[model samples]
Target: MDVKNKVVIVTGAGSGIGKAIAIHFAKHGAKVVVSDINLESAQKVVDEIVTNFGEALPIKANVAVFKEVENLVQHTVANFGKLDVIVNNAGIGPHLLRTHESTLRDWDRVISVNQTGVFYCMKVALQQFLEQGYGNIVNIASLAGLKASPNNISYSASKFAVVGMTKSAAMEYATKNIRINAVCPGYTESALLTQLINAKPEMDAILKSVIPMKRYGKAEEIADAVVWLASENTKFITGQTITLDGGTSL
Candidate 1:
């Protein structure tokens, strides 16, 4: 869609790829809703967008919580007066641990936020879309969804579910004017990646080893893909997963 005047919601917009996508949408004239668990971080993004003269709203929400997700949509509609697009980008990758070594807490937290969170957001967003008869959704998945990268079972499983859910929703709404798609990224250079790198410097070499590009992806690169998916350019496209893996998944 011509994002020139669209209302878009970007969860996890406080940092990394989420922030980049929100900024791109705003730069292109969309009224963006920057929702994140960090109020200060979300506000900072809103402040930057406003500085650029783009309209945006900063909201603090934990997408994993049903109530918070509900309030998020309610508030967005109230402020923007309508809904057009939603980027289910909030996710958590589990730290390195063998399958037998992973804890229940680790599994629950990752699955709840990364998997169930997408469902909650999509559920509420679809309700609005059905009422309005139009909508777009982009779920950020990962290369792990397509292949076993070892470790990160919870994250990988959640992402795999996202891809399936995107396809199922797209088919279910094929004629209903609601589009759902996913973006599967390889290891991207962002705050999350940085943290992982700092925790284990050897991981840097290991991550690059799997990538044919021999380099990490930038947040802006992934953002570009998301904006295109959200735009009219992909109007006929749904139930698809676009991989920006720099050949890592290949």
Candidate 2:
């Protein structure tokens, strides 16, 4: 788990799981780039890191846009002198509708941010890694990617693409010193889950009942896995999807 002095970027790092990942990497002595669509939120995380005597920089970038994603990577390298890791953590949750009930707009929006955004970040980061000779990438997928998600077609489709992309890219670059991996978290405690639970309180019990642990995963727990995937400890592991579902997937 040695990430000391490594230049890392975590997208959607303004809040929730992405925020936790950024903070965790900073705490581990990594020079973190807190990239989020919300500049204010990203800066707040950076300020908190600075207060904690950790190095972090805030950058406003919408991952849905390739240009913005490219700029995000460029800025990180310019500021930190090298890029070591990029966490593709920015994503939108499902619309909670069946395939037929889901709107085309929802599908497009989710695909743009959740699927295409990961591609953009990975593409740019891969280019940088080729130049530098080594790098790591950790994508934040979801349990839906590994198994069917009822009433969540678009989200599942997007995350599945992330899993596929992670493996494909990992194999393609394995010999080039670039490692790619993904984390699939299920019902993690975050603003996204809170919002879902608030919208349908009954789902709270239903979700907990299905899980063997009978509890939701914490954001920090997901962050821990993400950081480990990006650390030197897992240098030999790549193209794998690490599921953190508390046995829910079972």
Scored by CA lDDT, what does every candidate get? Answer: 0.92, 0.95
Give per-residue CA lDDT, model 2, range 74-152, as digits (tens).
9998998999999999998767888999999999999999999999999999999999999999999999999998888
**Candidate No. with top lDDT:** 2
Give me the candidate number with maximum TM-score. Answer: 2
RMSD of each: 1.0, 0.7
Query: Model 1, 179-220: lDDT tens per residue?
Result: 999999889988768877898899999989988989999999
Candidate 2: residue 68 Cα off by (Å): 0.3
- TM for every model, in the order presented, reads 0.98, 0.99
Residue 165 lDDT in model 2? Answer: 99
Task: Determine which window of 10 residues in candidate 2 has minimal summed lDDT.
Answer: 91-100
Global lDDT of model 1? 0.92
